[model samples]
Target: EPEVTQTPSHQVTQMGQEVILRCVPISNHLYFYWYRQILGQKVEFLVSFYNNEISEKSEIFDDQFSVERPDGSNFTLKIRSTKLEDSAMYFCASRSQTSSYEQYFGPGTRLTVT
Candidate 1:
């Protein structure tokens, strides 16, 4: 079975540096999304993309964040000028819209900003 996969499962970076987290979801899935969970906080949606354009985005997706599906295979989230508050677990998910909205999630990338 195809499952979502993420790279650099653990990341340690400086507060002002850039971070690129990568993910590859199921091959036939169409919708992709990014969400984050702070240490002990609830998961929050960041953005969603389909057909090479963003379909939805939360206020958290400000000028510092971006999402890309550059090659039709891998999806990525880039954070510029990371912040201590940005330290959290980032998840990449995907699923087809044809049925229920159930989502398949990646193992997640834990980002630690120091």
Candidate 2:
């Protein structure tokens, strides 16, 4: 089965810098999402996308954050300005139209903001 893939397994950046995390979800999936886990915290939803538009977003997904499918295969999350609190393991997930409850997750990108 196909799986989600993410780039730059780990990233380190200074506070106030910009960072872009990339992913490639299962090609056949219709829904895409971005989630983050702050250290020992539970996973938190950031945003969801479908058909080239944002379907829903959490409060954490403020103006500083954005997501887009720049091409047929690549999905990206850009943080305009990083904050110390933004350090976490960021995951990219996707599920088919028929399975809304199950998501295939990528190997997360670990972001460290100092």
Model 1 misses residue 14 by how many Å?
A: 0.4
Q: Estimate each model's TM-score.
A: 0.96, 0.96
Q: Model 1 scores what on Cα lDDT?
A: 0.95
What is the per-residue lDDT of model 2 for residues 22-81, given as tens digits with 9 covering 90 to 100? 999999898999999999999999999999999999999999999999999999999999
**Can you write out model 1's per-residue Cα lDDT over 1-113, one digit (the tens) per residue?**
78999998999999999999999988889999999999889999999999999999999999999989999799999998999999999999998868587899999999999
Candidate 1 Cα deviation (angstroms), residue 26: 0.6
lDDT of each: 0.95, 0.97
lDDT of 2 at 24: 98
Q: Lowest-lDDT window of 10 residues in candidate 1?
A: 95-104
